[model samples]
Target: MKFERSEENIGNRVFKGALFVAGGRFVLRLFSLVNLVVLGRLLAPEDYGVASLAIVVIGFMQVLSDMRVNSALIAMREIDERHIDTGFTINMLRGLLIAALLFIFAGPIADYMNEPKLEDVLRVISVVLIFDGARNPAFTMYQRNIDFSKEFRRRVAATILGSIAAIVFAVLTKSYWAIVAGTLFGRFTEAAFSYWKIPYKPRISFREWKVFVSFGGWLTLSGILSYFTQTIPQLLIGKYLGASPLGYFTIGRDVAQVATRELTGPLVVAITPGLSAIAHNTQRLRTAYRKAQAVILGIAMPIGVGTALMAKELIAVLVGAKWLPATDVIVWLGPTLAFTMIASATDGLAMAKMATRAMFNRALFVAVVSTPVFGLAIWQGDMITVVYALVFRMFLQTAVNMYFAKTLIGDSFFSPFTSSWRSLIAAAAMAAIVSAVPASFTPSDPEYVVLLEMMPRVLLGAAVYVLAHFVLWRLAGRPDGFETKMLEVSGIALGKLRRFRRTAN
Candidate 1:
């Protein structure tokens, strides 16, 4: 599966990779939907809150410790087995270190959060990091050549199977352990699949230790700052507000994030190989980065804003009335995710150019400036105040990152307002039109009725967004961007289809 990176039709490869990854993620999200529907009912907010405690702790460790060597591998012009071994060794060492730390400090973490149940959970969840460390680093080789088949197969199969195990465990145990079980099973599956599929023996060697430290130093710093910026508010919420409210906040955030990330994250992944291929050419990389960011904003805004508009209906349909406390959380998270996701493109550009200090600065600004402000809000107000402060921080970060991204992207102003203007207007129009739909649902009626009403609004919102985009594109004299790129591909597809039909006849 490890093939030489192809220089042929890089754009097509990026598009196809995006579609392939996005398709796999789509299937994965369906399984997640099943889990949400089933688990949302089976578990309480407190159970979810407790589960978030273990997750955030592990995630904090993983993020802070990440060296991003795989990313370096993808961008490198050439790599060998020694490089792979070095990456693996670093991962394994980091995992064991994190595991030992968490094991020793689980008591203190639980004591701080005032959740006695969390200490046991953190100890058990530490096993997952071991599996994560053992994952096959060679899989990234496929991504370098625009090959996502192995990734697609392994992730989809693992998620579907893991979802089944989690549901069954939930039904039997009816505890937060089900969440822990699912995470463990998923990581184990990924680790086993990597070894089974790649058939490579990684060793405990750091022959390319200097190369890794050189490339990943800034990456590691950026990652730690990024993790702190994201997790600080959640940690504060758990400390000040308690587990139950944290549960509501996390659940709402998860649902909102899945909608935006699952759709547009693939595009970011898809563009990395292309960016790496053209890193030597400043103009092409900047152009590619700009168009990609614009597309993601255009696509994600509708998903995020529309989700905000449909928050009440979505919550009612997904989990039932018991979890209605999360409705406002989702509403706030929607627009917030829209703004924050723009940073993903800037991150990839920074990684490709090996100027990750720009990325580090992006995250560092938020972590340093926002933490005290968010802490003040947590103290003065409540969960909602903290949530609002977090949202405001992300919005500010987006603007700041845009300036950083422009420095890498060249001297042009890479403002979201300028690049994503059509999308902003289109999403606003769609939101305005869709807001007329009543958010209330009849609890006495069948659940299908809620879905039945929601179905039309979703479709109408989509139609309006597309129609608005097309009109603006035409009015702007057909600018070169994501819409143009999609159209060009569509034309090629149509031509092929027509040729095939004529030949068969």
Candidate 2:
């Protein structure tokens, strides 16, 4: 909970923090991906369908119960015992309210969804919110200080433990309850670790509740609006299309999201605090904002494009042929993932600037616009319509988010695209090259040939993308940007490594 002020360069600190977070995600998501693929093979589609509904309901309640106090604590320039205690108090109250609601509505929700098993699952998962509420708020100080290395350790350990637990349970039971148990155990581990890591005791107070509420009021509304736009697919998909189809949609969307979410999630986590550290300086904020977006898109654009191109093979190899129906959804959702990644950093920028009301307005616009389109698609009761609607919603959401973000940060609305066009073009070219590979080159179904065929194709595709991007950067006069900075850093690191090796010899 103690804060350490670093006299380091802001950009360096941000870059290092981002590296820690991204590295952690890469490791943890590998664990999670393995667990998911294994579970996908072990459990039936109906199990995921049930788990998806429970997750949506849980997320919906969590959204309604959001106070955004942790965010306020992160954004606030000054902090005190009262402020931290009030955040804890509000969290406990929010957790209790959400738990009570879930417990009471568990059966009703199960009945409404026509899934009798959800009642017990929902009740069990409700405890997660309480654990979340009881956690110390001062742990956020680590983030505010840009000490993501510690954050990285904490999250990676918890995720590994959770993944192991989930895999064990899935192997034994092969049921949706394994998913619920994994989720609950993960939250429990995180909460317990927060107190152990931070050495802060929770206390009840409302002295600073007004301050938190003042800053977080708009954010609370924004969270609620986001649930409707974001979780609507899980909520309504089952009702219209049945659990089996919803299961297909759920897995497809989950796998597709890894393309951008795993890459950008940590950067988004790092950027809010990083941007806040320099919020007073307009020039620094603008530079940091643009770089964050560029770096995220630079990594994420190729991932989305590559994943879409290899959707069929990836589903076949990773999650198995049983999930082939999910391939179409994955392909169409790729562009949506790309669009979301481009806009991911903007929310952090807005939070740093305390533009919560502007964020609320942006969310409201997306909700209002996307809701009816999503509804009409669901009304059609077809998977293709649902995919089209989801993609359309993502595009609309991105456009609105970009406009408001520009207004808040005083950047051009087209800045993201302009900064990342090279990455986009390179990714497209790489996908084309990979896709042009003849089926004759595709090896037969033995595991070795599958790895031989898929591995080389993927590697070649990635190499082409990197080479093309670099060539394009050179042709454009090698502008001073994230890619240039990354190259410089890598070169310096490599030189140090070589010198150290020579000294050791």
Candidate 3:
């Protein structure tokens, strides 16, 4: 009974966390979808492409400036006011430096890309980095404390405001600069609102600088390498393929990331701090890791496979015909995205063990392997080749991360894999069946009509996948009593929802 209760608790935590994340992701993605639709109509491809280059540069620098300190802070078992103050100070200083650098280099960068307008755009976006850097480290504390309700409210407000600003500006100016302006406004608004919502205030004292550096330094290294690994492809594409092709690539990557972000990312954010709380207990850690893996894979694998199969219709319907090129890109990158979801689930173990160096090493290896492959692909002048290189790198990165996570958690490599393989296989089979369905069901009506026609097939695929997944799981020795585990997860989610309601009241 004790064992059962413990298992039940794990199920509950995962379920509730997943629900919170799923809900937050849905709202955020919905806002983004609306923003994209409006902006896509208003702005030109070249406009988006030019901004994409600056954003890639800014994103890379921003990761270095922030250094994932928020995550490191949340992962720590004992944190104090001084730690928060010192972390904020460090973050602000880093942000200031990076912003200044970008401002200074904006001219040269614009010149290199043969786009003079980007200089001002880059300068304007630097302000956003500074504001984001100035955010109170107490926000991390909120997450550490598992107070996502507050976080969720702040995020939704910021997103809504930002989306409105972007759409308004894009419609008014019909230029690329409006997108940059909108982003800056939204970010600064979020920083200010987040500070207002959270209780912690910032002090410029470096009193806990030593401790912050000791932990955050490793995180900073890992973040820098990870940022480079993800962004280098874009940078290379912009440089070689120029803005047009880079624009298309950026649009495709953004669509894929947005779709997966709401689905896979929120779970990581919600689970990591909780996982840190129980990190010292190997059994608890194993349970958390396994359950998180199962849930993420169960959702992500099917979505990814289905997205790959339905990329054309989905992109056409959602983003319009102008985005047709993104469909092929999404298809090629889908496998990597699926595997990446599983790899992210193990991050809690790494943080709990203070294995920052190991994480950094893995990220460095991926960056090194991928940089040359990306370069080669760019040199070869083919988008498909670039996509294949990305998939290969993702596989390599996932394999490496899994080895380290398994070593840390004292679980076999096959443990998490076996737990979800049945569902994955079923999802794949279901995807094939759904993909074979004809598009003739749609009459020669409006575009929205065609989208409506595709919905049934998508829903049918999902239903079949879920049914087949359950059947396969049961046949595979009913690992963890699949139905019981789901019930446990649902119960926990419900309890959390109740607690949140009570707290709200």
Candidate 4:
């Protein structure tokens, strides 16, 4: 409820804020699952292919134009209205220009892909940029203050409204247009609700242009290279491999990335303010960075391992038989996405210290190296090879990122492994149990039967993971780490529940 930052309960606020934002993202993911399931049944793989091409173009433009000023604002210790106004004005101008270019260039991009229908889709999705850019700058204020309950409401409302629009359109048209409609509606609703959540208006100003540019210049280069590293492969697939294959890859990649991203995004966002506040304290920063990375990876590793183990049944249950080819995507990309998030913690550390050139160099190296490697995969005509290539590229990048973190935090290169050793062992155990469990159904079995087969594996895997994780932690003498922190919190929660129950009785 408070817009001003408070020093009291800093730790509590960080956890609470992360949970609120994570809760909102979790709900959004549920809505997206509904869309994927229903639309997968209604539309063909080719529909996702066409939609993906358009999305790639729009995604590139957003990366090109984004100064990441909200990040700058959050990381900066001192700022005024001038910085806020400047960020808004830049976004507004960028949005208008990018939208115009997209509308004008849709034909050429589609022509390049040899998909004429893609032109209309690209043109329609361009409006999303305008809505995104015009969103209220006040939203950042809540984030900077580590308050997120109000933002959660806006997200929930937008998700419900946009999802309903998407499902209704899918039922009526049953085409790619339904996908376009949902995206456009979601961005519009989010932008509209931004103002309703806060009572602040921004003005057009460039008084703090130098400040933002200093913070974002290297980040811009880094973002552009990062976008290409991911997008080049996609565009190549669409052009060389074919639209249907592109559809499978896109759906698979998104599924893996979205679930992992939603899991890690809260800590990534909430930690920036905390990190920035102590940027000058190297000892504290090192400890915090190691522990935070440990906590995040500890939570993510098991989920990734489980998803890979159950990729076949998950694909069959969610997208049906025609999408079975995408199963390889889920298999490799699941672990890749999880590790990618673990590596991303290093980027936040760099940003907090205002040393973004390291990030830029890292992105440049990955992009330069990955582009040709991915191209070679496509030339081999094995899309499955591309998935393998993707895993290699990401893991290599993650190592590079860890090296950078070592430079920043004075930790060893293999600190990540050391920080989360318990998690690693537990995940391995979970994977072994799940994979050793015999399949209950053949590939030709009905979806319900496959679903039944997957459920028990999921449950058993989850149980083994938790039990193994705690036992390993206990065997280690309950060292002061994330596991101990988690158990203490659980105990506090249980005590509160008991007291509340007694009062109710």
- CA-lDDT, candidates in order: 0.83, 0.83, 0.75, 0.83
Residues 57-86, candidate 2, lDDT per residue (tens digit)? 888888887889888888877787888899
Which digits, one per residue and each the tens of the lDDT, describe model 3 over residues 233-274? Answer: 677777777777777787677676667657877777777767
Model 1 reaches what TM-score against the true structure?
0.95
Considering only N, C-alpha and C atoms within 3 Å, which residue pairs clash in candidate 3?
A: none
Give the alpha carbon lDDT tens digit for every residue of 105-222 in model 1: 9999999888999999999999988888887787788888887777888888889878988899899999899899988898889888887748667888989989888888888888
Cα lDDT tens digits, model 4, 401-459, are 99999998788998887878888888889988888999775777888999987888999
Candidate 3 ranges beyond 4 A from true positions: 1-14, 441-445, 481-485, 489-505
Report the poorest 10 consecutive residues by lDDT, candidate 2. 439-448
Candidate 3 lDDT (Cα, whole model)? 0.75
Could you tell which candidate, 1 or 3, scores higher by TM-score? 1
> TM-scores for all candidates?
0.95, 0.96, 0.92, 0.96
Residue 248 CA displacement from its true place in model 3, Å: 1.3
Task: List runs of model 2 lying over 4 Å from the truth.
Answer: 1-8, 440-444, 499-504
lDDT of 4: 0.83
Error of 3 at 322 (Å): 1.8
RMSD of 4: 1.8
Segments of candidate 1 deviating more than 4 angstroms = 1-4, 437-440, 489-505
Candidate 4, residue 15: Cα displacement in angstroms equals 1.3
